[model samples]
Target: MFPTIGDLISYIFHVNAKVNLQTFGSCMALAFAGAYVVFVAEFKRKENDGTISIVKVKTASKTMEVIVNACIGFLIGYKVVAILLALWQGQDPVALLFSLRGNWIAGGGLAFVWGIWAYSTHKAMASQFIHPYQLMPYIVFMVAVWGFIGAKLFDAVEHFQELLYNPVTVLFSRSGFTYYGGLIFGALTYLYIGYRHKIKLIHMADIGSPGMMLAYGIGRIGCQLSGDGDWGIVNRHIKPGWIPQWAWAYTYPHNAINAGVFKQGYYELPAGVYPTPLYEAVLCILLFLGMWMVRKRLRVPGAMFFLYLVLNGVERYYIEILRVTPKYTLFQLSQAQMIALLFMAGGVAGFVWLTGRSYFSSTKQIP
Candidate 1:
């Protein structure tokens, strides 16, 4: 029912603060960062003092730490800026930041951050006891499960009856959560655990690469199945009769069948809409294939991950054209559109420099 990004925020949370599923997910990311910091500090100390001296922070560990810290710093910086923006409008930034004072749900948000950070750091210190890469899969799996539950719970809060009829469905329900919620949180969880255990991210990324794409593809399937409102439009004007009626047509269970109908009538997606997420999954698999083939082609750190960003950005940008999400326009382009452009720019820059370095080196005469 809510058409625009602005409306979705207001309608869902009744807040003009510009928060949504993404923001909640970011909160989880921060928790991951906090956890990593704790893990790194503790694990490193234990390794140095331990009798067996079995612990070693490998290159992968360092890279993971560095990248995660940078991400966390960015999040904190953004939050500070948001605070300043609020203050300029005479809003109490501090109050807003810690508004979890009375709300259990908001408290959970805060607690999610604290809990993950604490638990992860504690585990990281003893990570030497386990194989780094061996643990990453489980962590990511946990992230997938928790992230889904978190997003679904948030959605159910917005749609109270959906929870009332089948409370258990809140945990199993598909299609109601946001993708970014899972990505941001899931990535953070993996990063924290990987860095803590000093997993070789470069190689590990290659190893786990397919799973990333596969997981996303599977998640999108959930979205399509539940029709939790991630449908694309059926551009009646552009496609005319070319578009099938079923392409954008969807029927929700009538009131008698489900808890309650949040939005009346079947959702009529915008015409000519592409199933971008599904398309993205396919692209990810292809990109993963490319990365896997050349896992050993480059010696540089973070090469595969950098490539992933580029691929992801490209996929997202192309899909934005067909997406109907709300946006803040800049030069007539949506926020996601601009971010994708930035990702492409960064990826291209990195790729060029890396390849150039490699190309010159390969041609150099060796004694």
Candidate 2:
């Protein structure tokens, strides 16, 4: 496994080309990009089928647009200018960009330029109409932000003692994510935003299901590729006749976390662990395909979403058994396991109730 894109490139081309691109981060980004495409497709289909209608909204003032762009520019300029300077000096990026040091002058200049450009683009427009799919980019951005925040918050809770010892380090570190936390928070954020857009809860839920599942599946590929410690318990079992050993168990060489003792430049686990992330990626992608295939057939408003929940819940619950997660004494279940059960229960209840109603009746009524 390659920890970073730099490492991957080094291996592939036999060069010491140093790039700052992180494997997990890159894949996480890819996950969102792929999901965005899926979402666009799903939304277009719904629009074509007349399941949803176009939305009309007032545009913001040119001044407001400039302010927003300027703010974004300032942040980007701050980091990017510093990064470029570091590259010029051949300094350690981890030490440079990760620190508070930045060129404020560059940031201010960039912000000014960005604001002017935005002002130029923003002519007087009272309102505009758009398909709900146009909002998916912003929706994806919100999910990434809130999902990351939620994951960090949950991780903090899980390691309260450690957090107390080093609050800044634990809070700011790029690793230590809890997918369930992200899922819950992201779902809430999506629903809330969709509601604000006047999209029906049922339709919102239905539209988000396939894309969300696909994103998770793709994101898990990052976990597998980077070996970010989402693996299962040690596997020392004898090899099966038909199964490949690498598939059954992996030592996770060149792992990102540097968990095991380092004999050489790179890290490697002493023993093999079940590649749970790979398993999840495989299962979820398959599930996503199956769900996507039958989504049209499930005419019930929330039926597709409920099916996603049930299948995802069940998969996580079983995978938790094989995983090495922190468990609560209550029923000896992990936090994720408890959440999984809740999801399963809620999914079943919601699925049955929604499916009982006639989709035709719901379709005729606007949200």
Candidate 3:
């Protein structure tokens, strides 16, 4: 249901071998390094140009100002976030925060990093605080929160059977992150960020639409490279009228889903179901092309945004048929299918509203 990037990395490097901490640590370090480089480059572009300005904290008082701002941010974020989680799951605030030993450390680290970054950036951009670019902080914050919370909630839902045995463990586990879950929530979170920024919601949506799809594809590549459990089923021989064995056939040694025939505590799926994530990633790239084109051609408010919703919904609904997931009811509908339907409705409604506006009354456009 959930896979960590570490699993794929381990499998790639040494199939049927243990994944050691040192190995994982090295990979994480590399990832962080690459991320920092990109962050710095973007920050500099904003800094060097007139888009954003940064001034050094020259005095002790200014330093304290930064520190206080950072602290206030952390408290506000933690308190509100904790309360929301508690409300959602009917749990104690303290219990939710400390459910996993790593939760406190990870959450605190995220808060600290974003808090300090926002404080410093805000101060630097203070002179132009009201500029349109001021929306970056909210966007970044939305991405982080949506990704983290969505992943957690999806995991909780996916493993409801396991949760029946130990609800607390299921809710708190650090291991239950689904990449697509995070992606979906992150996109929804952008709506609020858009409203706050005073950008027309659909305009803001168009800005991120292409990037969002591409970024998700990148994340899937991470899932594949890490060999987290996102892999498809395995089959010994090629299915009739399908791709040849040599082209698509590959063994996933010691995969938990496919390792039942291997030994105790290890499992593997029977070969050749579908490399669904890979297929999804490829389709996402193509979908991104459509989004980019529509954003360029469609000037109507919300048109590109609606296009994204419809296209993404259609893609996910079709892909769900090939993936292994818990189905609800006798109809065997998947969780993603439910979300896809919602997206499709939103898209259709938006398209209808935008195109049917009074401004276009003089020229009747064909459907």
Best-performing candidate as measured by lDDT: 2
Cα lDDT tens digits for candidate 1, 1-367: 2222333467568878442222222333444443344333323433354311332443335446545544444445446556556656655454455433233443345445644554455433423344333343357457766666556665565455667887776645433564544565566666665566555444444344444544555444434433334444444444347745334443323211232334456343332344454455456656656665675564475575567668777877777776655555357665556767886887788789878988889889564
lDDT, model 1, position 260: 30
Q: Please identify which of the two predictions, 1 or 3, would achieve the higher TM-score against the true structure.
A: 3
lDDT of each: 0.50, 0.86, 0.58
List model 3 lDDT by residue over 1-367, tens digit each. 1133334554567554323222222333453343334334433443454433442222234566567666655665656566455545544343444443223443466568866775566543323334444445545666767777897888888788898899878777645676557777876786666564444555556555566666655555544433446555553554566665423643444542343356455554445446666677678767766665555467555676688789888888887876667789957787878888888899999888886784477466545
In model 2, which runs have C-alpha deviations exceeding 4 angstroms?
81-99, 103-106, 358-367
Instruction: Give the candidates in order of lDDT, highest first.
Output: 2, 3, 1
By TM-score: ranked, best first: 2, 3, 1
Off by over 4 Å in 1: 1-129, 145-177, 237-278, 281-301, 359-367
- Name the runs in model 3 displaced over 4 angstroms: 1-127, 130-134, 179-181, 232-251, 254-267, 358-360, 363-367
Best by TM-score: 2
TM-score of 1: 0.49
